[model samples]
Every structure is written in structure tokens, then in C-alpha cells.
Target: MATMEYNVFVGSETGLLKAANCAEEKWNNLNTLEDVKKDNEICCMCWGSSQQEKVYFAQRNQLIKVYNILSGEICEEIELNAGEGKFKNIAVFDQQILTALDSGIVNLWNNKGESELEIKTGDKLSCMRQNFFKRNLVATGGKENPLKLWDINKPTEPIFTSKNVPHDWLNLRVPIHVMSIGFIPKSEKIVTGTGYHQVRVYDPSTYQRRPVLNVTFDEYPITALTVCPNGNQVIVGNTQGNMTKIDLRKGNVACRYKGFAGGIKDLQCHPTLPYVASCSLDRFLRIHHMDLKHIMHKFYMKSRLNCLLLSKKWPTIDDEGGSPTDVSKEKIDDMSDALWDKLPVLGSKEQLPSGKMQKTKKRKLATKELPKQKMKKSVC
Candidate 1:
């Protein structure tokens, strides 16, 4: 394979856009979003075009920036009319840009086509995710908001909306505060995190409007949620700097991980590798191995990171020095082999079938016979 390739892009709280290509060798492609004052605090970014060279990003200043990844040039800029409230989510579908505002409004714009679609989500929004299997479908929710899915082609009504959980022991109606949302790949099922620090999975196909499975974490609002590529588990991070990998099938935490000194702003897992990258108020980008729970790469980007996007491609065995910075299976095997090579060889021992000890033969000392005469010689 001629160095498999995938693109990675991240936008930070300080309004910087970083881009790079992951390949067989260490990635040297990086960009700092410092020069453009308007690009500060990138809220969302994605491949706006079919080509790998172009991308679109939403900013905190109500401006959307389009850039050419290969040339490091701003190709176009579209301004959002939505007043106040930061952008919480953005996605590209059918050559149109869809942005969800914290104030609960979603706008779909086609700058080149000069067509726009807007919808009022009622309550303010915090996050939005598109169902890859259903390109025309999307899920959106936020603080005190219920998770809702809409068919973008219509934009007037939601196809599904989550029903609140039943009353507690006191029979008080439970309030909902959706903080983040994720859609299961290839299924109508969706998962959401809430301000109450709960993770719930909902299947719209079922008659029950309530979550099929609901689990709680630490008492902090969930800030980030990412479904594993396998679509069997979801990685959740909350406002308290807590992270956990929840097994959907088991309906419980599969593993607990540590390392975020500050609350996690965002998390993204490698599509094909057992690695996850996260950036947060700690001002550092950390890549972790899901299985080993090892921090593979730690890069101080010198800013509070709010979001991350990882490449889907991973290095393979045949590539030359495949991804020196990435901790893939090939790299781990090589490291294990090298580690075993450095271990000390043990001293050889005789093989024994039974639990018996070998007795040493007693030899008569040649000087023993003279021992009895030692006193006589000394006296002479």
C-alpha cells in the first residue's frame, strides 16, 4: 500500500484551525489559525466538499470560514445572521452547510447555490450529529432540551423526540438536560448525554418514547460524546473531567480512564485504530490507546482546545516507518518484540520430572588424615 492517507482537522477555543494528513510516516503537516482575527474560536469543521483539499468551519464570531487545506488559503467566508449564542454543531450534507446554534436554531445554507433552510429547535441547542447511514437525517439536543431527530429535507418537524424518563421514587417528573448527542451508525438508534451526567440510548423505531437504556456517571454535565467506530460503545466525557467508555450492549461502563486535568471539551476516536484524541481546558492534546490505556502522544498546542477530528486511516505493516507518531498494532508488536529482546536470559537448569532433590556426593578430604597430627607438629 502506497502510504494510506486520511485527513485530521481541529479547531480550538482561540480561533485556530489545525490540519494535517496522517500517512505511513510521521505527519509534519500542521497549520496555526493565528493570523486571521476572524477565525478565532472555531466551533465546527468538516469536509464541505468532496475533495480532501477543502473544508468549512464555523466560528464564535458568527462567521464561517472555508479554506483550502493543501494551500493554507481562505477560499471563502459566509456570515451567519443568527444573533448571539455560540455555534454548537455544524455538518455538511448534499453540498450544504448545516449549523446548530446554542439558542436552538439550525440553519442549512448553500452559499454557492444561494439556498437556505432554517428550523427552530424550540429550546437552546448544545450539540448536533448526523446519521451517516441516513444522509438526510440528523440528531440535535442541548441543555434542558430533549434529543430530537429531524428529516432535513422537510425541516419543519422532527421525526423523533425523546420522552422524559419516568418519575423518581417521589413521583416528581424528571427534567431533561441534553448536553451532547450521537447517532448509532447504520441504525435509527441515538445516544445522548445530559447536564445531569447521564448517558441514554434511544431507539426511535420502538414505540416507547423513553430511552431503552439509561446510565449515570459523575454528577456533571456531559460535554462530549463519541460513538466508537464499531457502533457498540460510546466514549463520554463530562464537565467534571471524567471519562468513561460505556458498553451499549452491557448497559454499563466497560472501562474507566484517567488523564484530563481539566474538563473534556471534545473527544474523537481513530476510525480504524484503538486510539482516541482529546483536547480540553488543560490546553494539551492527548492521544490515548483504548486497550492499553496509555497516552501515546502528548502535544501542547498552547491553547484551550474545544474540539478534535481524527483521521480514519491507520498505518499497516508494509508501509515504511509507518506513522512514527501513531501507536498502531504494528508499532506495538514491534515494541513488544524489542522489549522481549532486551530481557535477561535466565541461567540454564536441569529438567526434572519429579519433585526430588539431587544429593551432593561426600568426598573424603585428602588433608583430613593430617588434621589429627596438626597439634603434634605445632608442638615439635
Candidate 2:
């Protein structure tokens, strides 16, 4: 098969990796159905190199599969034995592969899949993220695990460790459950989302151990989050399927996107564009414009999605070979019309000969009826 370029790559719970071209509305399953197994389900994914020509994904089976974008084939597979639980996240730096497991074991593997260095971050590691600007720096956190920043070169103790917030006004201890982490660009600040519905920003440069900025979203636990390209805001998704963009400066909600039916699993902001892509347990991959606050493209994969990766080479709307705004608006209108047609219309109420109300079919009108007391008063 010829090499194919895709804008989006999605990993699913069924152990299937799919590539999509948003402009073309095309999808291709990179893995065969025969290889699909419970243990092969992908849990985390990261670009293998800055070139974006390859991808590294970790499975529940403790295997890291590297897929080549140029040839569209599995280039290599690295098995990980240093971790105990499922992989929470994976990162690539230099030529080494970094894998973090729920047991809090972080291992850096060489080309031969030999462990070069290992660091025990903490227990219940929910997330591990590398600083894109400083590839050698990484952050890790999880349930009851405060955020810690490590320098992979010197894999001894963390350079900076975050302290839990002080007790609440009622004198009750606060909980710590860092479910996701993101490093803001052009700065050393790190943002984290917790299971306690909190979004916090930590400044490593400051002597203060606690968060410099802390804000809460909805009532449910935050499951996924990503810093936007602007670095002034971060987008977060909760367990209840709510995705909101929050201004980091003031710690206020900027906007919220709709159309999610299940909890978000992963979120990725485009490196250069005003777009953010998200995958959810609802089995849908959606791309939304940050400013528009509306979905630009939505694709339904047969299996539940776990992680999403957006290529830096993703095509712009104009690259789709048409007027960008017109084409997108037309597509959106067609989809909306189709969905509206499928919905059943409510019938209007009408009086029958016996003074009872009857409904007329095929009409789009209010079907609500007056209560008995109101009806009697109106009749009298």
C-alpha cells in the first residue's frame, strides 16, 4: 500500500488504531481485526519524533508499538516489563521511549527495549507529560499523588514537587487526585486537573509549594485537559462530558463546547491552529474551533476512543480546495438538517366532541396539556 498522510490519529478501546483525513472525510484502520484483543487496547500515544513521521502507542499488554507514517506500517514493537499496571502515558525524547504505568514506575528504554533509567514517581500515576520546549523535563501526578517535575537526564529526585492545598474552611483535609497535566508554553508553569474537580497552575520558579492559581469546574472529576496554543488558557473535560476553556490568568471559564455524550478520554490542541481535538468513551472524535466554540468535524468510530493525536502537518481549511467558511457551513447545515428530519414532531392539542383534548399528528407544536383545575376554570 502507498504511504498515506492523515490529519488525525485515534486509538480505541478495541485495540484498533485509526487514521483520519478531516478534509477528505476518510478513515483507515491501521491495524488488522485479527490483532484486536482486550489486552492490545491502546491507552496512551505520543509522536515518536519531532518530524511527526512516526507514532508510539502503549497498550494494556505492556507493549509499545511504533507505527511509521511514511510507510503506514508497524515499524517496531517494544515490550515493557518495568511497570505493574496499565500504561498511563508515553513520551519520546532523543531516541529513547519513556513509559509510565499506574504503579508509578517510569522507565526510559533504548532501541533494544533495554531500560536505560527508571524513576519511581508515585503510586496511582494518572498522568505523565513531557515539556515540549524542554524535552528533558517531565511531570507526573495521580490519585493522592502531588505533581512532581523530573529531569530525565538526572533521574534521581524531582527538581520540584507540588504541595497539596491547605485544609478547607471547615478544617477538613483536601484531596489530591491529579488526573491530567499540561505544561504551558514559553514558561515553566505546569497546569493540572484533579479528580476533585480542580484546575491548578504551579510555578516551579516560585518558592511557594502550593499552586499559584487554583480554580474549580463542575462537580465531577476532571479526566483530560490540554493547554491551548495561546498558553493563556487551558481546555478541560470532566467525567460528565463537559469541556470548557478556562483563562489561566484569572482562572475563569472562557467557553464551553457541546455535543459530547460520554466522558472525555483525551484532548489535544493543534500546535498552530485555533482548533482542539478530543476523543471520548462515546466513540466519537470531534474537532472544535477554539474561538467559534462549535464542532468543526465529528466522526463516529465503531469502538470507544481512548486517545487522540493531531499531526502538525494537518491541513488548513483552505487546503480542502474550497472557500473555507462556505464549505464548513454547508457541511454543518446538511448534518443538522439530516438530524432534524429524523426527529419525531410533537402534535398540537385540539378539542374533541366530548370536550377532551386530542393530539394532531404530523404537526410541530406544543403537546403540553393544561392541568384539570386550570381546564375546569377555563371552561367555567
Candidate 3:
């Protein structure tokens, strides 16, 4: 049996791991329904290896499963012993696995699955993301919890801690509910999406710990965000299913993407391609081109999706698994070819054996003349 090569991997709230082939517009459930349980619900997912040959997903029951992409099997399962609440995110750095829970506990496990270090950042943690350029660094923030950058090596104190913005014109303190966090590539700047419908950019290199730029989207809270490869813009989605691209330089909305029905749970951009993948509570996984106005592909998943990982190895003709072909075109072409082969070819001047070409005479009709209207014409 040949396994399908998937470019998009989605985790559902009902404990189903789905793999989607964007080129073919088809999806498959990696795990069966029998393996699904309430406690096994997937909360977050990340690539287990640099080559993306494996997947690492954390569940609600504090269990982490390593899925092998080539074999299509769960090769390893590691249960997290430290941490309260559900796992929020998982990251891998230098062969070490890091897991963060909503209780604000980040545990570092070695290759043997032994807990080596644990850092208690804070409570009600909503998001934790690893820096792409610096693997040892991570950023965390949540409801009432300010953004903090931590170095796993030190683990003693946060290297950078963000301060809340100043009070509004009404003298009321600004609320802090960071739903998603993303690090801008090639720079120390970090972008965060808040539950207060704000997209903020924090610069650690600055003297002040407050966000250097702030922009608001829709009325609802921003649920997910992903930084573009250009490092100058960020795409954010809210609970109202509205996604917008914000320019960090001018702090303005650049573009808005449509075709979502419910709250967006997660957003991930392709590492090199000009495409982005998103999963939502609407039970659909959609891929949109960064330069186009319409969506590229949309798949209907059976269960509500939580998080999705976009593989860097996009499907091509030379990939291990076969490439997706247009079945409808192949079938239609084959039928037309067969029909044309069986049909008889006729000569231009050929005639039937019973008779040659015959000509028929034209018929003439008598003309009728009416009384002339000279008097009426003169009056006109």
C-alpha cells in the first residue's frame, strides 16, 4: 500500500488528525474514530523534525504523540507529567521537546522523555511561540499576562518583559489578552494579537518595553496570527472569521481575506511559497494565495479544527508519492479519443451507390398588380 503525501496537517477538537493534499483537494484521517476520545483532543501541533518527516501533537490529557509521516503511524507517545490545564503549544529545539500548558508551566524534555527543566512563566497562558532565528528563545503571553521573552538556557529570569500600554483618553487601563504570538524573521521585533482586537508589535531592542506600534482590526478578539516571510507585514484573524494583513511600518490594514464562516483557530504561512493555510471552528481548512483575491483551495473537514502545520516540502512531480492528476480531464480525453477512432471518415465528393447527385428545378410564382395610389401619394 502506498501512503499519501500531505502538505497540510490539521488537528481537530474531536481527536482526529487529518492530512490534506492541497494539489488534489483531498483529505484523509490519519487516525480512526475508535482512537478518538474527549481527552485525546489535540490542542497544538508542530513539526517534529527539520525535514518534516514527523509530527508532534499535544493532547488535552497531557499526552504527546509523535506521528511519522512516511509510515503513517504513531511511533512514539510521551505523557507530560508536569503542567496543569491543557497543553497550549509544543516546540522542538536541538532534539529537546518543549511543552507549554495553560497554567503557565513550560516543561523541557530530553530525548529519553525525562523532564530536564521546567519554567513557570504565569497563569492563564494563551500562547507560546519559539523564535525562528533563535531556538533557545521563546515568547509567552496571555490574559492579564504581559509578554515575556525567556532564554531556556538561563531559565532564571526573563530577558525581556513587555509593559502594558498607557491608559486610554478616558483614563482606563488597556486590557491584555494575547491570543497569538509571532516573531518577525531577521529582526528582534515580535508581533502579538490580543483579545481586545489589537495587533501590537513589541521591540526588545528599544529602551521602552511597551509595543512600538499598535493597530486594531475588527470588533472581535484576534485569535491567530502569522508573520509574513517579508518581515514587514503580519496576517491576523479574529473570532468573527475576519483575516487582515497589517503593515508594520505604517500600521495600516493592507488586505482582507474572505471565505470563512466561524472563528479562526490557527493560521500558518508557507515558509517560502506565497500561500497561507488556516483552520477554523467552521470545520474547514483553506489555503489562500498571498497575491490573489480569491482562495486557492478549501476543504471541508468533518470536525472543528484547532491547529494546522504547513509542510515546507510542497508536493511536486518528483516527490516520493505520485503527484495529483486531473481525473476528469483524463477520463474525458480517453472517451473522446476512442469515439473519434471508431467513427468513419467521409470523402468530400462521395455519393450513395443507389444514385448520383440530383438537381431540382426552381418554381416560379405569378405576380399580382394592385390599383395605383397616385392621389394618396400626392397628398402625402
Candidate 4:
């Protein structure tokens, strides 16, 4: 088995420090917010690689700013239109910045403060997600009763759109409120968490609703959805302070745990490990391993953690010699054939819930009443 390493990097009242291995609780006062120059209420934090340094981005109500982790200095800052609306969502793409407005639009801007594009969306443009495999494509959905998919190159029109696409739980009778969206990494399917504690996966090729994965939460309004680095597990965090993990291939619950005292708002998986990080209204940033035990490793923040991003672990080529040329191609082919024979087929309807709402055999419509089309007066 490959040995996995875990590390906790936190910013606290003292300064940025790598917590003593497995002794996170002992290393209190790890750092302070003075490193970022903010009054607090930080909604998002992301680490990205620039040149040889790892840079971090932290967004508050009025500013989208960047910091060089190596130098511990704020490198760039741009004023965002987040006065009345909090900078609830922030995504860093190349040098371009994408932010979602509570006012129901997604704005893209360049590094030099030039507005790139704006996507007008539903009533509450609650969340926005980028494709893990393709950065240019983004999906946004919220109380609008519809999910919008837009390509960055063409912001005026969405390539795909769907309403009442089973984005919510079955018991919820309200219009689909797509609170969160997550991509399945390399796959075309993406899952969105909705208001009723339900998550739905759909094929991007066609906007039709497909497999409805009912998630059990301690409460309603699933706020975040994230796929583990392995791509085999899906996890969702809800308002009731529960983070449930499900096996995507098996369509079965893998594990469930109470992530925080208050509701969970956002979660991010380690870029290269099986670790998961989440933030909650309970004013805590917690990290856990995606396993049966679901060990709670560290609690880092004091205010509600609105968003998080782990540093990407780039893979390095082994200096040791690889497979020898003497290894026959026929032997490799034989091993591949054996593995294929044991692959599991994902073709079963999930077991119906017992106390929960009956599995609706027929798809639910947005509204029972269809609008009447007025009959034009006969010209004759």
C-alpha cells in the first residue's frame, strides 16, 4: 500500500505555521489575520501556484485580495461590489477572477480590474462551480428554479439550462434551489445539492435529470458538495452540521459524521490526498480523513468558513527505474484483462428510504398548474 502523508497548515492569531504533527490543538495561536489586513468575516480562501511561490487568495465583503505565502505580503487587491452583497463566492481561474453576487449574477474580471463578463442568473445566484477538468465552463444555480451552464468564452448565452432538474430532495415541493454544484472531475456528470437535502447528478450532454441520489442530513438545505480526490466518493455538507459521504460507483452511503456544531457552509478536498476540509456557521474550520472512522484532525477558524481550497500536490516522476523492457507486453495485457473482469457495474436503483418520503416513481414538475395561452380572436 502507498503511504499517505498529512499536514495541517493554518493561519491563526500568532502567524502562519505548520502545526506540530498531529498536535494541532497544542499549537493554538498559530497566526493572525493581520497577515491579510482585514476586519474579519472572511468568506473564501484559496491557494494557487504562481511562478515558484504558492499564493493564497482571501475574499471579504468589499475586497478580493491575493497574498504571497512565501513572502506573507498582500500582493494584489481589487475592490469588489460586495457592499450590500457579501463576496459569497470566489473562484480563481488562470489570472481571471470569478465572483457570484447575492443579487443574482456572476461577474468575471481580469487581474488589471477590467470587467470581463457578467452572467445574469436566477433570483439568488447562491453558488457557482467550475468544471474540474475544464476551467472555462462554469455552472451556477440557486433559488432561480433553474441551473445555468456558461462557457467563459461566450458569456452571453448558456450552452445548457435546466429547471426543476431534480436538484433537490424528493420531499421538498418548492422550485429547485440549486444551493451548490460539484463536478465529478474527469467525468461529464456533475452533482448539485438542493434545498431538500437531496443531491442530483446529470449528464452535461443532455440537461435531463438522471440518477437522484437521496442524502440523509440532520437538516435541510445542503450547502456544499465535493468529490474526494480519488473520484470514487461524493460528500455533502448541510445546514444541520452533518457531512455525509456516499460511494458514487455503488450508490451507497459510505460514512456520515457531525462535522461541526452549526451548519456546514462549504467544503474542499485536498488536491492530492484523501483528506477533506470543511467550514461551518459554528465558526470552525475542520479537517477530516475520508474513511470509516472519519477522524476530526483539526479546527482552524473562528468565524463562519464560507469557502476553502487546498494546495494542489503535483505528482513527481520517479527517479528509480520503471518497469524493465524485459517485462513482456503480453503480461501487462493479461493483468489489465483480470482487473476489467472485476469492475463493478453502476446499474441499480438506490434502496428506497423508510421513514423518508416515498421514492417518487414519476418525476415532479416545477408547478402543477400550467400557464394558459390566450386564444387569439379568430380573424374571420
Candidate 5:
């Protein structure tokens, strides 16, 4: 039997896209695609619906491009709805493609690139998500906007709306700024990451609009969130470079991993592994094991990273039961210890030798006078 393989596709700040066949020990970066230029920013990306071989990428200019990962070919290109606005998320299923715009409008497009339906969410729309189990159900939220669920079939009204929590101790109404949203798997609830540094879960099956679960994290805004495979926890990243695992069942911080130097832009978990990957404004991509607080690999990507897509498919190992891909040898050869030693260390202090004092030397001009220049001959 041929083993299933999945490749990871990444989008950068300059719209540079890359694919990699990942393994437990090493991975290989595939050739770059000329379709995504180095001048535009990537808004979001996701695997295509109906097939895992294709992926769709949205840009800052409202242009969407589809690519075949295995063949590295351009499958199709479609323009978003008229009136330029920042691109949001794309949810692909069967013959339909749903795109969310920053203007709080969700557009449904057919395979032939025709707009079929449009849903008006609200203003300041920061995030939107299509239900994982129920394709027709979608969630939307943003600044000062409560969480809402809508049915794609009935574009007129939302099925449910979340009620804001009671005022704070000072009686000031709390604000809403949901930066990211996703549907909970194997359940009827949804999770959201907010600008208020909160991770909230909402269940619409009940009549109450208040969140079923609410937990506060760092003081900085939570920019991105992804559900763990177990469906009982979520990995959340904040603008203050804090990435933590929050247990949904217990409503407490599970583990706090380090490695983010700049603010995080996106966070994604491995398809069926215990690894987590992140891209950020620091122009670096970092991967770490969920159980380990240290980094596994860190790469300087030359451009700020906005979003990343990890394919569900992975390579089939050999009959010997070991993966063929190994980067250890190449990684060791690629390392330059001498080059690094010659470079200046940032944020580090110069240390003097132990139990030794060095005297400073000043340069002095020569005490002996030099010979003067001879006069030139004037006449013959």
C-alpha cells in the first residue's frame, strides 16, 4: 500500500510561498513558486476542499490564487468581490469557496468563479470561520462585535449571537475584538482569540448568549489560535510573544513554550503529530514540540511571515520503518561556527579574562623628525 504524504505550504510577508515534505527528524524545502511575488503580503491560506492536493492563497490586494502542491502548477486564479478591502479567510468545500473580507462581507464562489451568495456580517470584522463538521454553519466576530453564527443557506439572519459579559468592577462595558476564530471539532462549540487577551468558547445549542468558557491570558492581544488534535485544548499566541497551551476542559494554562522574538502572526499544529509551528513579524519560522519548552528548528525566512498551511498528508516510510529524509548531515555541514564567532553579539556584554587586568595602549607620533621634501629645479 502506498503511504499517504502531506506537504507544508507557507506564505510570507512578501508573498513568497514554499512547500516542504516534513519528517520526524528532517524536512526538505521544495522549489519556490513564481506566482506569488515578493512585493505583496499574504493574507491567509488553506487546503482546498474536496482534495488535499490543492491549496488556495489570498493576498492583501484581494487576489486569490490556487496551486497544485504535488505538481507545483497553477490550478486557477479568481478575483475577490469588487471594492478593494483586505482579504481575510478562505474556506473551501466541494464546489464552493467562501472568502471573508475585512469589510464584514462573506462571499461564496462556485467552481466556475461566479459569485453565488453574499452574507453581511458586521463592521470591524477581524475573523470568520466555517464549521468543521457543519459546512453550512459559520462564525464571525470582531471589534465591539459579539460572536455570531450564520447559515449559508439562509443569508438573512444569524442563528445565534453571544451576549457580552457583565461590566467590569468599574462599570465600564468590556470591548470585543476577536482576532481569530475556529470551530471546535467533535462538538457544537466555537473558540475565539480576542484583542482583549482572552480565549473564549461559545456554544450556540443553548439559549444563553454568554460564552460557555472564558479564560484570560497575557495582557497583550491574542492574534491567532488553533485547536489541538485532542479537541480539548487550543494553542494560542499573543502579540507580546507569548504562546501557551490552554486546557479547554479545565480552563487553565497548560504549558508555555518559548522562542518567539517578534509578535506572532500565525500558529498551526502538525496534522497528526505532537509539534507546533509558528510564523511571525520577526521574519522567522519556528517549530517546537508541544511537550518541550525549547525550539526544534528556527529559520530566518528573509521576509515577515503572515500565515502558514501544514498539509494533512505525510510521507510514507520505507519498509524498514524509518523515514528516508534526514537533514542532520546537511544541517551540520551548513553550520559555520567560525563565521558566527566573528560576528558581533547583540545584547551581550564583553567579558574580561578572570583574575587578569589589561592595560590600554595609546598610539604616539614618531619622536624623530622626517626628512623634508627637496626643492624642484626651476631653470636649465
Candidate 6:
């Protein structure tokens, strides 16, 4: 039996929890009813903290709720309302959180829930990200054709901006809807994910919109984009459940691995390993090793998975059972017996915790394994 390498962060309309080590990962159910009712909806977006103590989650109600994962309690909830509409995304910095709202305003707040500053974007901010090197600077893209860079210190408007740079070789041939803007790890070069499954890597210094790669898929929207930890591979997952790793240096596909049954809603890459996690409306959390090119584990959830995150520091649950591959027929049968054998341990029917619920002999569990293996291969 090996220790589970991944711990899934599950968030549904009702609540959220960290589902841990099991053949089928089970929810620990950390969110209480009161918390869900207060926020209206469970987090619309959730990000795993680089900091060990916190898990960042946001609700549709325009509230950014930060949780202390170790204690399973809310640490801070910031009501983010700039002027109008709702916030679509939130990114955390060293000591502040940057929230991109529907009104094209990015609000900055500290851990104590106080507004530190606000960056006003002239266009609806569909997507945004902090610079990889400079924390004060941020990049945004959306309804506007140009990708704008803002400085928090200025606090009034963008310090520098670039617009409609021709997408000659980079092939940026679509609307900016749901596009993503990110800077190359340590370089001044920046990259954007066009809604049309094309990735444009831009050299900010030269304002060149070079098509790094044009990733084609069926009709599925590009749901999520992440850069590899090594900063050489660009991993993009589309709504069609296709995860492709492209080598930035060679501008070629490294390999493709598919696991999510439905369109991917979110994609997260590990900080230290070649592993990534993706969630979809299919209600399953899937783990894949980018290097191994195989499905590592699959865990079912109660509702549509809106977000998926991976961090080297998030806590995990320990189990005695073997890893997903090592499970044997005999072990499963033994588990089935143990599930029933524990019933007699109850002194009497009246001694049951529910008491009124009558006790009946537990039936033997089913022996069918899921057909997900075939499904995983089809998309790959």
C-alpha cells in the first residue's frame, strides 16, 4: 500500500471539503450549512494556497472567503463590491488579494478584509494574473482588444498598455472572451490564451504577438491554462477534456493525457512534480502524471466540480489500503466482508445510533469495475 500523492479539494453548491486517501476518495465535509447559507453559493472559484495554512475560495455572491484548511474554519471573508456586477476571478499576492470584477475593476484587499487599493480597467476584465516576477504589476484581458498592465503603486490607472498587436505568426484569430494573460516565468515575455484555442506568447518589450502555438479542438471552450513548474511546458485543458502539454522551446506537443469524463472546468499543475489535477461537470476529480502519461487516480464527488487545485504543501489523509493500481480481488472481497462484519459489533438493534432505523443484513457489494479506462483512452 502506497500513500496517496494527491489530496482533492472538493467544492459544490452546498459546501467544500478535502477528500482524502481511499480507493474512492470520501469527502471529509468541512463546510457547514450556516457557512453555505451566508455565502449563498459554494465557491465559484477556489485556489490552493502556496502558504500552508490557508485555502482561498470565492462565492458567486461577491465574497472572497479564505479558510484555514488545518482547522476547517473560515479565516477571512471579504465582501468584494467595487461598484456594480460580480467578480469573476480572484488572485492572491504576498499580503493581498486581487479580485477581478465584472465591472472591469480589480480590487485589492489585505488579509483583514480592508480595501487596500483598486485598479480600474476600462474594459470588462474577463481574466487576469499577477506578474511572475514583479508582484506590484498585474496583467488583464477581456472585452478590450489590448492586454493592459497595471501597477498597484500607481493605484489610479495602467502604467503601460499594449493593444491589437498583429497576430501574424502567433495566430491569435478569435475573440478575447475567457482569455488568460500570464507572464513567462522569469522573462519579460507574456502569454495569452485566446478563446479560440490559440496561445499567443508576447514579448512585452517588443510588443510582438507571436503565435506560440495554435491548439485545435472540437467545440469545447478552453476552460483552464497553466504553465509547467519548470517554465518550459505550457499545459492547457479544454472544455472537451483534452489536456495537452506543449514544449515552449520547440513549439511542439510533448504529449496528451485525458481523464475527466466531461469538459474540464479547471486544471491545476503541481508545483514540484509532473502531476496535474482536473475537474469537470462529470463530478469526478482526476489526477494525471504529465511524465508518466497515465491516469493516476479517480475520485467521485457529490456535485459538479467547479474548481481543482494542487500544491506541494496541502495536507493529505493516510490510508492502509493500497493505491488505485494495487487493489486486489481478494482485498476488495475482504473489505466487503468487513463492511458487513462490523454490523454485529453493535450490541442490539435498539443500541444503534439512529435507533428507530431498523437493522437488516447487509448485502454483498457489487463486483463490477467502472469502464472509465476505455473513456480515458478515447480522448487521449
Evaluate all candidate structures by whole-model CA lDDT and list the values in order.
0.76, 0.89, 0.87, 0.62, 0.76, 0.65
The candidate that achieves the highest TM-score relative to the unseen native structure: 2
Worst 10 residues of 6 by lDDT: 361-370
Clashing residue pairs, backbone N/CA/C < 3 A, model 4: 12-31, 12-32, 13-31, 13-32, 14-31, 15-31
- Candidate 5 least-lDDT 10 residues: 359-368
| Stretches of model 3 off by over 4 angstroms after superposition | 316-380
Summed over model 5, clashes come to: 4
Per-residue lDDT over 7-124 for candidate 5, one digit per residue giving the tens place of the 0 to 100 score: 5567876676655445544333332555356445678888786457778888777677787766766678786653546777888755678888878888888866678888889987
Clashing pairs in 6: 170-210, 170-211
lDDT of candidate 2 over 183-249, digit per residue (tens) = 9999999999999899999999989999999998999999999999889999999889999999999
Candidate 5 structure, TM-score to reference: 0.78
lDDT of 3 by residue, 198-279 (tens): 9999999988899999898889999999999999889999999998889999999999999999999999989887788999
Candidate 4 global CA lDDT score = 0.62
Candidate 2, residue 326: lDDT: 63
lDDT of 1 by residue, 84-196 (tens): 68888788888788888888888887875343888888677778887767778988887667888899988789989888998999989888788888888777789998888
TM-score of each candidate? 0.79, 0.85, 0.83, 0.68, 0.78, 0.71
Once superposed on the true structure, which residue ranges of model 1 sit more than 4 Å away at CA? Answer: 1-7, 20-39, 112-115, 313-380
Which residue runs does candidate 6 get wrong by more than 4 Å? 1-6, 15-24, 34-39, 42-49, 165-174, 207-219, 314-380
Task: Find the candidate with the highest lDDT and give its number.
Answer: 2
Q: In model 2, which regions exceed 4 Å deviation?
A: 319-380
Ranking by TM-score: 2, 3, 1, 5, 6, 4
- Indicate the residue-level lDDT of 4 in model 6: 38
lDDT of 6 by residue, 1-380 (tens): 44333356655655554454434455455566565553455544545444555667777677777767566577777776556765566777766787877678788877667777777776666677777478777887776546777877786767556555455577865455546665677677666666667666666566344443444533555667788777777777776788788777877778888665677766777776556787777888787767766776677776776765565653332367443333334455787899998776666666666533432423211112235656688879
Which residue pairs in model 5 clash with each other? 5-313, 5-314, 6-313, 6-314
Candidate 2, residue 283: CA error in Å? 0.3
